[model samples]
Target chain A: MGFLEALNYPIYVAIFICVYSFLAIGLNVQWGYAGLFNAGVAGFFAVGAYTSAILTSPDVPGRLGGFGLPFIAGVAGAMLLSALVALPIGKICLRFRGDYLAIVTIGVAEAIRIFARSEEWITGSSRGIQNLPRPFGDLPYVYSQLAYLALVAAILLVVYLLVERQSASPWGRMMRAIRDNEVAAMAMGKDVPFRRLQAFVFGAALMGLGGALYAHLGRSITPEAIDPMIASFLIWIMVILGGSGNNRGVLAGVTIVWIIWTASEFVTDQLPMEYALQAKYGRIFLIGLMLQLVLRFRPNGIFPEFRPTQKDSRKPDKSDKA
Target chain B: MLDFINFYVVPGIVTGSIYAFAAIGITLVFSIMRHAHLAHGDMATMGAYIALAASTMLGLPVYFALLLAIPLTAALAVGTDKLFYEHLRKKPKILTTMSTLGTALMLRSIVQVVWGVGTTSYAKGITRPNDWFGLKIKTNELITLLALAVVVLGLAAFLNRTRWGKAMRAMSDNRDLALLCGIDNARVITLTWLIVGGLCAISGFFLGINTEIKSMMGWNIILPAFAGAILGGIGRIEGALVGGLMIGLVEELSVLFIPTEYKAVSAFAILLLVLLVRPRGLFNGKII
Candidate 1:
């Protein structure tokens, strides 16, 4: 491949990174900052993707089609739809901690997948929906690619800015308190459940946004495309490798993981037939290797360890009274 | 009367029994370790593949093949706990739950690696039909159902009568007290893996015999298994048994009114409803 074509691969991979990094930031906000591990990011991701596809697909009438809204509208719809779903999911999930929440989220994602498969009216079922509308129809493929990239990048930047500002805010501080010590936070009247739900719902919305972008890029949507293994684990890996609580670390993690993922895709093509077939099994091996290494050596992750601030750490054990 | 007895009730119980097999392992792992073992499906998958290899390659009788798989799968589970989970004991519970996902991925890859990426079927001779009261049961299915009953009885006896079982129960109720009382956490954890792996292997074998052996086969019904365990209450082994059978029956019988494609609907629906309305599970965490 020539230079631009070679550049094509990295850029395509970067597209996934930029979108994924947005999600990692949200997850960092939830699990890294507030300690809510959500294994159902895939569900929200699918919700967002399908939302945009259904709204913008040429085939679908009424409901959401024909307005010819900008890509931004689809992005907004994705976030809103996903967040809407997450509200109820969050309600149920926020009540449980530890494994209960983990399994419940996985169940929710699978349930969504099953519904998506069963309800052919909403999603196109196993056949999937195709020909998703791009942001600028008049533009060429390369410009469209670049425009879409720019669009996602712009959204990522906006989210990063907003989340950054929030993290620096009082709400962020209280979220950390709740995560570090739920009982103490509850005693202090921090609205522990509400805060947890907010973090989870918000993070899930970002997952939706990423999914919408991914659907546009691939130009097709299918239940087969929605594998929870890759969708959930890869994001966790990114958030961890990047430093769960740190946005910058998450950005780095997404970039590195996506690159590694892309490179593996290329490198496997060069391997012998059997080895190639072995490597073809979806991104599980790479994701596992990263988690194993991260857990073994750098449990805190590649960025810095997320530590409670001195102010928060010094707070009294008010929860003990309860 | 015949429809209720022949069509509805018996089928529900049979499928529910299959689900119970899965629930047993899931409940044990969750109760003892306090994390949802996402790798449970893959362990079942691995076991099914092992049994497939044994029965087909070695020319062993399928019954002996299944018997061989139970111990082999249990050993794998113990090794998995020692390697991955033991270290995770000190970490936060949710993190470990996410970590089991990594283990799940790793295990599936290993399954795909050892047994190529295709489906394997039990030999026809072994899977042939056997008449039991004119019910037209497959020899494989009946053997699986009976094995499940025997295993359930065996496990109940072990838990009620043995030191390890009592310790496991105490640990599930309160880990801190169990630890303080000089209960060996390591042994209970190891034994937890042992039971989970054993039943998971049996679940996998019958699944292969009833359907087919594929990497994702165990996971396909995982939600139902989750339904079974949680419905039975997390720590209660008997709850898992009943829960699984109930879930299986519901799933199988739903096909009468709905498309077979929507079969997994019961598992997720029951799971979501139970989680929402009865957060403690159907049995309300009732220890049997």
Candidate 2:
């Protein structure tokens, strides 16, 4: 194959990496910083993807579309709608324990999947929304792939910088404080529930944006594309494996896990049909096994959370104590 | 009304019994271990598939196959705890919950690989429902209800009468206090898993008998099962039973008011409503 052809594959993979990074970063804000367990990442992701698809796709008879909005509006609408959905969910579930939140989120995601599959007028019902506007789609395949990669990468960088800034601020510190010791944080007058809701909604919006980016890249948004195994659990593994509290670590994790995942698919494809199908499941088994091992041995992940040391002046003096 | 009772309520009670079995397992684990056992559904799936193998491959009868599966699934559940959850005992409880999620994925993948993701049953031909006083009830449905009654009564007897069961209850009520009382925490935990796993297997088997056994069957029911568990009260087994039945009835009867396609939403809606209005559950279960 030609050099550009080889480059094309890498570019496509890179675009996906960027997309997954968005989800990982979003999850990190919830689980890593705020200690919120959200098992329904795919639900919010589907909401985002479908919202954008409906917003941007050309008119389709018997379905919700014909807006023909620009890609930016679609992306914005995706984030807005995802956040809106998260608001009530977070409000209700965030007050309870983390496990409750996790189960509720799973239910919500499943409900959303059902809605997308059955509500034909809204989501085109399993067939999904088609003909999404991909930026620079008319360009040649290789160039277009590269251009999309650049676009996603640029967006990822901007998101990374903004998130880093936010996490480094007092808000991040308060979130960590709440996560580590909820009672203590509550005592310190940190409106605990409200703050948690903020994190949950904010994280969901980012996930929605990631979905929009993915939908546009594929030029379609299908119900099949939003499976919980890939869209939710995979992103979870990325965040946890990368180091949940660390954005850079999560990005690195997205790169590593996505590569392993797709690379294994390539190897499995070369196998005979039945074995190949088994191999696909085997890969999931391995990933799940990998998670157990990771949680067991290295719970903090490859890059552990960095705790800033307090100044010595804040330490109690031995002489004064004596 | 008679048609609704036959078609909707009968099936509802049957499925509710299945969910009750699953919910009981979930409530047991939650009360004893203090974390949501996310793999409960997949463990049930594995149990159903194991019974499928026993009946199909080993030529055992369906009930005998289920008998074989119960202990095996219980052992698997206990082993899972030993391998994956043991080390995380001192860590945050949420970590163990996440580990179970991973376990869920692992168990499901294993099922998919072995079972080929296709629907299967013990027997190919469909059995006609026998009419009982104007109510149409399948033989399997009657079997499910009887089994549920037997399991519930047996469990109640065990919990109320046995020393080990009391110890398990003590641990659920107060872990540290139970430890102080010289109760063997490890043994109690093992016992809890044994019961939970066996119950999960029974539920999975009933679901298989009632409906087609597909790879995703357990997964699809897990949410409603959780709703049932929470609605009845997390630690209370009877609560799970009532909650499971209620959820099943609501889901089936929802077809009256809404499109059949949206039946699953009823469980989720009930879950949200219960969580919002009564986090402590119907029977005053622990908030956690």
Candidate 3:
């Protein structure tokens, strides 16, 4: 019995790791490559979750949704809606530096939360949209979970390959160049704001896809499904701690942080009845403390950005002398 | 007309005063430290908690608790800056803002662990508003407005006339020039945090007095405070004050046309409009 439970536990953790890896990869594009600070990961995630939930879930009376669309269409809808939300926000704030983007994204996230909570016609108010379709629903519990896990892993692999290829392409180099030196990129005649917007919308779509996957896994979407402060901030920590520009580092970071987070949660759950709530909050406090420590001690994270080799560095060139 | 003043204008001014007070701290930090103090609202929650501790544990009056909270919160604010933010001063200012978001979560979690996630008031029981010249106002609301007026006036005088305030302004104007002119950068930063902490306490205390205190109150107020700061101009104190009041009025008046649940949308709309139309703000604040 204990062996069965242990096997199930790691499987659950693995599923979550896959979901969070998608978010961290999305953030890697925005922050690592494009130098955009998106504080509203939860917002895009919610949009995706809701879009998929509304599309796939059967009709509930008095609600605006219940399209009964196919699962693929739902996922696509999630990504498309998330990008649609990102477009206006990126257009308005991408013209400025990252500071404005940070605050505006936060505000936009709050606005989305407000709309979800208040717009009962769409979000079903406090009761939330339910009965979302799950893949492999007819199988045994463990097998169903395993099947969903495999599906998510396959999606993560595809996203990972696509992002990796993009990062190696000329567009990725131009993004990094713009991030490092906007004036130099501008002198080269690149439109900085437009490129940043593309990355922003693209990254948001990935986050939305992550959300859709999570919604389908849970078979529900609610205002409380994603805690903006905790869920969104956790993804930020993953990307930052993993080494922002390195995709492998992001995957590693997600696994480590998720383990630590869940391990702490397990310990807190073991506490006596009265202290459980306090312990839960204490765990939150520690997550925050960890962020500060990592920022101070390992600002470049475990795996710093990898630079390509240049053969001519053994001798001083004319430009060096000048 | 009387009903309008009693219902909307009075409450608007009271709420606006709270925003103005908080925005002052935000603007001061932005101007002097060159970063958005994203933890500003959570710090206010800390102050309110400190005051709650003072009142409950020591049996101090609510106003006295506010006074006690100022110095304590200032010390804490200074400590956080030295530990978390001071090192980041050499980095891009925006990174400091990011760290402050972490700080906000940390501060709020600390509050939650200690106080739990329940609402409480400084002094219990309802107090009915008094009528004067056909205008109804709560005594706390009256005191809030008066205190705001005095603080704003005193702050303006200090900025324009006092030596330390002038030094702060000099730093805000140009950090390198201020250092070259022999102003103490460390002293100015500490002083700014001190004032910011105190103002944060005042605003938090007033908010607690007017409404119940809760762990999430600070988070809820942050966007409005940011809206006010941006509306008035980021670095300009007077602009922040005016902008805060305007936001307060607009938020209250918005209830007339829209659902009360959508009140925050108005503040966000204001923020976007300001960002798009006049990023420098109404007072033509420093572009930086």
Tens digits of per-residue lDDT for model 3, A144-170: 888999999999999999999999999
Deviation of model 2 at A107, angstroms = 0.6
- Candidate 3: pairs in clash: none
Ten consecutive residues with minimal summed lDDT in candidate 2 chain A? Answer: A310-319
Return the lDDT, model 3, position B90.
Answer: 89
Worst 10 residues of 1 chain A by lDDT: A59-68
Q: Write the per-residue lDDT of candidate 3 for residues B49-101, one digit (tens) a residue.
A: 99999999999998899989999989988988998988888887777888888
Q: Which ten residues in a row have the lowest lDDT in candidate 2 chain B?
A: B114-123
- Given the true complex, what DockQ would model 2 score? 0.79
iRMS (Å) per candidate: 3.2, 0.9, 1.2
Question: Clashes in each model (backbone N, CA, C under 3 Å)?
Answer: 8, 0, 0
Ordering by lDDT: 2, 3, 1
- TM-score of chain B only, all predictions? 0.92, 0.99, 0.98
DockQ of every predicted complex: 0.49, 0.79, 0.67
Residues A132-185, candidate 1, lDDT per residue (tens digit)? 777654576566666778887887898999998898899888988898899999
Candidate 3 regions with alpha-carbon error over 4 angstroms:
A1-6, A309-322
